[model samples]
Target: MNNKDMKIHLTVDVWAAQKADARAVRFDVFVIEQKIPVELEWDDMDEHCLHAVAYDAAGHAIGTGRLLPDGHIGRMAVRAAGRGKGVGAAILKALMAQARQRGDAEVVLNAQTQAEAFYGRYGFSRDGEEYYEAGIAHICMRHVFS
Candidate 1:
């Protein structure tokens, strides 16, 4: 990795996600980039979910993910500039760590259809038929570990 890629740091916090940071990153990736509706972007589950945020060296929020008590991971988003640079992986590792700490043997998520392969790299296996959420196609997936 180059200097720019190596300079970023990953921070994972359970129930510690800041609203401002989550909104900013979500706005950049989901709303502006993916054209997702703002009203749908933010939801009631946020307040009850454990969120993880990744920051670039300049202190900009570059990635975000959330884990629910039932070990459901969702809303994983990496900024355009931060994509393909390990931010997503790092954030995922952090979320898994949170799950492990809570004694979860696995984590589940409804992944976007276009991103199934990406989640597969992290050991998430498709478990059900394709479904729609927020007007986008998704697949139910889960990560199992010993």
Candidate 2:
């Protein structure tokens, strides 16, 4: 269906990182779809982080991401069906807004190699060499607002 005809009502909400809705979306995208090991998927940092979750018209979580206390953004995930429909971008934008509200000087993330361009569109610039995490290629990116 065309973008307008799809009628995909997406709502992004920011909340505590450990909220069930956020965790559910991350589990589906990161662990189930990407096969990231459980050990690496769940971390203690979640409790202290700010998370954003995108929910569809049916109230089902479709995308999620988080901003850590140190200005690091991670755990970004969008369901397969949610890709290319602006859901990921929405999630990222919400997290960035949260960072700005907190007075962060900069925000950083390890972007999956293939998704670097996506982050770049949001003003994030590559900051370091490419590296591997969870067997996936990633590169450090940062967006400075101050």
Candidate 3:
């Protein structure tokens, strides 16, 4: 755990001022860096999703992810400066903890093909065939609750 012990204390409301950092991190990673279409990067579902934003020691947001009400996790993004420093892992652990607290039977995500092993390291199992979304390869993965 980092400074906040991996607790995602940001407001889940998309309209909240707290969401700006999360949005910035995602936009930088998905839209600018990955070239994902802007239209594909946002959705109405964000209004109801639980979001987790990771902050660097300097208090700048560096990573983020969301856990949908239906237990589908997505929008995982980490800035280049934040990768491999456990920022992604902290955000993910926070999101999955939120899901478990809500009694979700399982947590699911469409992980980038390259991140399959990373998610697998957290007990997520891949399912179905690989597919392309926003021109990036992805595979569905799930982590069942015990």
Candidate 4:
């Protein structure tokens, strides 16, 4: 871990109280930066997923991701200040840990193609053909526990 990672704080929580921080990070990264339609950025799944939020040293939420009951991880987003700082990694780790703790066989995600390599670094491999969602190219990736 780098300096940023050392100072980053992470929490795993339900959507009820973590939605505000998680929503802010997702909105800024997906809706604003990526130009994804706000309607497509949110769904009922959020209310049922276990969320992981990463905060900077100052306690500002900078990254967020969630793990669904079925072992699917999604909605990962990191703001500009958190990019390349291990914020996304921290969030992803927390969500995957949550899934593992719940006895999930594997954790899966539809990763934007541009981020395929990032997921690969964590042992996630492509599991399907490329597809488009909200005009962004993506490929399903999965990491099965040993």
- The CA lDDT of each predicted structure is 0.85, 0.83, 0.84, 0.91
In model 2, state the lDDT of residue 142. 96
Give the per-residue lDDT of model 4 (tens digit) for 30-100.
99999999999989999999999988889999999999988999999999998888888888888888888
Clashes by residue pair, model 4: none
Model 3 segments more than 4 A misplaced? 1-17
lDDT of 1 by residue, 21-50 (tens): 877888988899888989988878887888
Relative to the true structure, candidate 1 reaches a TM of 0.90
CA lDDT for candidate 1: 0.85
TM-score of every prediction relative to native:
0.90, 0.89, 0.90, 0.96
Q: Candidate 4: what lDDT?
A: 0.91
Superior candidate under TM-score, 1 versus 2:
1
Identify the runs in model 2 with alpha carbons over 4 angstroms from their true place. 1-18
- What stretches of model 1 exceed 4 Å from their correct place? 1-6, 14-17
Q: Model 2 misses residue 38 by how many Å?
A: 0.7
Model 2 gets an lDDT of 0.83
**Could you tell me the C-alpha RMSD of candidate 4 in Å?**
1.1
| Highest-scoring model, lDDT | 4
